[model samples]
Target: MRLIFIIVVATSLMPISAAPAQAAPLDVKGGYYHFIGDEGGDVDVTAQAAVLRNMEALTQYRSIADGSTFPGWQKEWINNLGPGVDRNFVLELNYYGAGEPTIPRPQTVDGVVVPAPDMTIQQRPGDTWKWAYGYRQVTSGQVDPLLKRALDQLKTMPYAETVNIQLGSEFDTDHEFGTTENGIAHGWAASDARALTAVQYIIGYFRSHGLPAGVTFSIGMGGWHRASFRRMHPEWLRGDVQVLQWNAYNHGTPRTPYQVFNRTRAWAIEDLPRWRTKEVVIAEWGTTANVGNQAVWIAGAGAAIKRINTDGRGFRIGTLTYYDNDPNWGELMDRDAGLEALRSVYTARPFIG
Candidate 1:
């Protein structure tokens, strides 16, 4: 049987008059995993189903970043599988380098090399390989056109209800196409004015076009200050936007977990109050723990959930979507055991009681 778990705030923490079931589920926490590839040529239906079955939410770039075959294929996938999944489907728009090369590249349209100013592709020799193979550029402006294209494609899809247009992810990283010099020229670089402007433009575009309701911007889990972005636009610092959406991959540092948790709490409790009223979303989080140390990782995760849930300051986090069977993060699942463990945590009622 499918397991369903609910979390309720304690009686002392909430008003006596409030209904016990009124407490909200932990807000926007979820997992980031690769579900589509190569224009959906080799679709992994089974694996995709397994992930959706296990996760509360998922973030995907199939229709945005790579459009060659993904747009049609993803639409099909969502149509076939989205009905049964109870989680949210956060669709990312390519506002970073994911769109650069595709943006109206100057090419021979009619067998004659003509300078198409409308075609804005400025190809660097290594950019394509870097994007496809490395996946490292953290900030890239090439995404603007790509985002427009993705939105257009989404309008044609059959499963609009299963979609949430996420403006961008991990804008603070250096590897992002938006942070580069080219990205800066395209208007995705790190000025508070520029970032805010871009956000407003995206929001305005979505609203004007009548996009779905679940659309929103997703900042990474990296502490706001640690984000390379803060170095460029320090004035945007507000106390209300909690930045805890990225992963805390341990690189063998003994104190990494402790430090990570502390930083997350500090931002949720302190930094967020100064910004807009936004809740924290651990949009992506996982540790690269080997099989021998899985217990330690699990314990650490449990502790994190307990601490965040029980904090008296009312800075409550919404969700804790652990990384499931990703190979990049040391492949948490050797077989199906990791799924079993995840099911246990997701269904357990320890936090509610």
Candidate 2:
């Protein structure tokens, strides 16, 4: 999503928490995301600089269209890196066929391999098509081959020591043809069921197939998604999916770094069951150039992140990733204030796994 650049602007900065002693620093990482297939404007050189500055987590969104070959474009720059770059890799994997019908190998339930469901594609209004499973179509068996493809590809890459797989992008605010079709579910209830089932299968599949030690799987959503849609079934937070991902963008509304932090924390942490915990990662975050003071805003955001990480709550945040624009939007690196501020945040503290 693009953050429109309007002339109206605001700026505010709240007190950042004092840094803890060096003996006990916060456990958070600074990172940046390169949009899929963006090759212009020194993108690779800029990304290399981010890593050299200790922004040790890098992500790229990969939307695999149905019947397309698995992507190896990451290797274009990754293979050229010098020794000891030491960065964790992440891929926000989105399959265009996520909501399509599938009859993969017979599904196993309670130790019995049952015949797969007999499903057919159904045509909906506006010439749209959905699988027989209806709105909730991200089934494990249907997406298994894609997942396998990802693991197999990653195994052959470098700097993929710690990998994170975000199943799909923000479905809560998803739309098609100007309508509110999430492509995953019609309502929150169905969303919960289908999401949980798909994740559980993912966890099991990863366990059986060895990849890396610190690999994590997550569910991604827009930070503005309603609390009802953010429900965390105890089943999701336990030993299954280890992370929750959200895109954090104020669109000039919250108007301050602290407000942005609180808004995101509420959705990523407070909205869930208090007893359960999972790593929260801001899969994408940014400020429009025309918005408030980008430097102060980013500094305050970094400070707020430090405050949250040191709060003794089990809300272990993984990464605060800046959203460098995709091919369609303006790049964050093009904004001097935003880029410098992110570099300042990354250099201020060390990130731990």
Candidate 3:
């Protein structure tokens, strides 16, 4: 208002003259902001692409500060520029996110009576790690006990502001979860009626139990079952799944860098939106035996993350979390070689949620 008033008064006082108007300072509050840092030494594409086109400004911002890790550097960046002056800041992290909601009675979908669920996901930005509530199979009779146990554990430790209710490890599709019948875990697959019911139950439980308001839930499923199931019930898209925690891997015995890139991209970009999920994530992605040339594959993967705006709503890929736990199949990423490979990307584009 002050700037506008001054301009109006000055205009009235001065005679009409040939003078160029001064440009106003930008209000960075509402603009496109991207996070280029890591939470725990994850991949950073912004650093690897020294000459990344359309990203020089971001690159320059990062160059001025130095820190042992991303969090360290982020503090420095904020001190230098101050918050809200620019639309970029480390996302407000939540340590004790509420567990899922209670599962309600099953509802009919496509004329087939299926379990009904209720849930919601926050669509902000931050890099996250989906630690498995751990189990090869879904344990117990109802979804409440299993979910309650996990929530109890989360209550003990409060650090992460976001939690992704990932379904079955990338390899488990037997649906060995919930009330089983005669040795079969039925209906709880991602696209199945029970899976949706379970997710909604968890969300309701969280609401009733009272987890912090800032905490958020990011729930989704893995396997061809859920993705394939979406075809029969497209209306499922109108639900509260915040991020698509789908897993993608190239199982070829001797995969090359480009091959790995292509495979990863197909899942994160090419295949995810078919389900109509707005925020996407490659919850589990990596190569086994031939985790091919880490830097090369990561850069290739970054290319897909960089170009993800198909629906015209600025639908960008939010995060890429690699499967680093299973030692049975892939190269141990904990080793220096893998860490270094990861560093290249982390150094380039550090973080996202």
Q: Pick the candidate with the highest TM-score.
A: 2
Q: What tens-digit string does per-residue lDDT give for candidate 2 at 160-247? A: 5455676556544432212122342344554445545655666676678876566667665666655534553354356666676677
Instruction: Say which prediction, candidate 1 or candidate 2, comes out ahead on TM-score.
Output: 2
TM-score of 2: 0.67
In candidate 3, where is summed lDDT lowest over 10 consecutive residues?
A: 23-32
Model 3 TM-score relative to the real fold: 0.48
Tens digits of per-residue lDDT, candidate 3, 234-318, equal: 3454354444444555455655534543343354344445544455444545656454554455445543443332323232445
Best-to-worst lDDT order: 2, 1, 3
lDDT of 3 at 245: 44
C-alpha positional error of residue 167 in candidate 3 after TM-score superposition, expressed in Å? 4.4
* True-structure lDDT of candidate 2: 0.52
Candidate 1 residue lDDT tens string, 1-353? 12322233344466766745424333323332433333443233446446434444544443234443223443455455554332223343332223453452332322433221221112343654122111112123333454455567656655555444433444443233343233333332333234444554555555677665544444432443443434322335332122324445543554444465456456444434443234445545555554245535544554565455555454345554454435555355442554555445544433233
Residue 284 displacement (Å), model 2: 1.1
